[model samples]
Target: MVTVDHLVKDYGTLRAVDGVSFTINKGDILGFLGPNGAGKSTTMKMITGFLTPTSGTVTVDGLDVSKNPIEVKRQIGYLPESSAAYPEMTVVEFLTYVAEARGIRDPEELNSRLADVIVNCHLDSVKYRAIENLSKGYRQRVGVAQAIIHDPKVLILDEPTDGLDPNQKHEVRKLIQAMSKDKAIVLSTHILEEVEAICNRVIIIDQGKVLVDETPAEFKARIPGASIDEVFRDLTKGSALA
Candidate 1:
């Protein structure tokens, strides 16, 4: 459902993403792994039409991201790294605003979508509380809730379970897995265990380029008797971590 072809992003003289190409089909949950400043977020931004690419192309369901930005964005649900939200708004209020912004004008539809995401993200307890009053984990859930509120065809998540507790992380992973059957997901994360738990495919990028693209099992098979972290370090040892 998503295709990235030779995507490149440059900021002045610095090349953030270089000739990165990948395709994600329905039911594919791609674990986008890289060290600090590895171009993962930059590539995602270009794909989501948040940033213009210096070269190459990104398409969502046959619509070019740059050429048909609004239509393409309509098909994508993006949860950026910061998970920025209005701290003053209550959970329900914030989500309602987002739902309307995404074009859910019908009151019945808006309420139904709101209800679905609240239950799915386990935010029922804090639905009426202001966002600033919630814990980091709960706030993160709110971010996920807003992203899925529109139920877009593609999900691009950065550090999806960043501040969640172990149980909360597991719950989020299960939710991602349950939604994968109908959507193309790009999940960027540092935790290898999270990838092994929920991602069917892994793509490791470094220094603005893709280094390894394969299944998690296949990636581990490359270095037998080694932990995932050990393998990751071995693969990226030469590149300076930003």
Candidate 2:
């Protein structure tokens, strides 16, 4: 459902993403792993049409992201590392605005989508509360809710469960898993166990390039009896240097 071909993103002389390539099919939840400044977010931004690639291309469901930004965006939902929203707006108000922005014009459709996201994200208790007053975990849930408000075909989530507590994290993981059957998901996270639990495939990148692309089992098998963290450190240790 999503194809990234030799994607590169350069900020002046500094290259943030270099020649990254990967494909995500429906039902695949790919764990995108990398350390800070590893270009994971840059690549995702390009794929979502938020940032134009310096070179190469990203295609979503057969539509080129650069050339068909609007259409491609319509097919994908994105959550940045930090979930930003109008702090002044209530949860329902914010979501109602997003639903309309996503082209749900009819009142019935808007209300239906709003209700679905509120329930799915477990925001019923805070539906009428202003976003500024919510806790970090609740804010993250609100972010996820907005992303999935239109029931997008592709989900690009950066640190999806960043601030959630253990129970909240489990709930979000379950929600992602439930949504995976019908969508191509690219989940960027630092939580290895989360990846092991929900991601079937994994891609580890560093210094703007992909280092490992394999199934979770294949990746774990690389270093027998070693945990995912140990194997990951072994693979990208060089980039850890200053």
Model 1 pairs whose backbones collide: none
Q: Give me candidate 2's TM-score against the actual structure.
A: 0.98
Worst 10 residues of 1 by lDDT: 233-242
Can you tell me which runs of candidate 1 are displaced by over 4 Å? 240-242
CA-lDDT, candidates in order: 0.94, 0.94
Q: Report residue 99 deviation for candidate 1 (angstroms).
A: 0.2
- Candidate 2 lDDT over residue span 1-242, tens digit each: 99999999999999999899999999999999988889999999999999999999999999999999999989999999998899999999999999999999999999999998899899999999999999999999999999999999999999999999999999999999999999999999989888899999999989999989999999999999999988998888866621
Model 1, span 52-103: residue lDDT tens: 9999999999999999999999999999989999999999999999999999
> What are the C-alpha RMSDs, in order, of all predicted structures?
1.0, 1.3
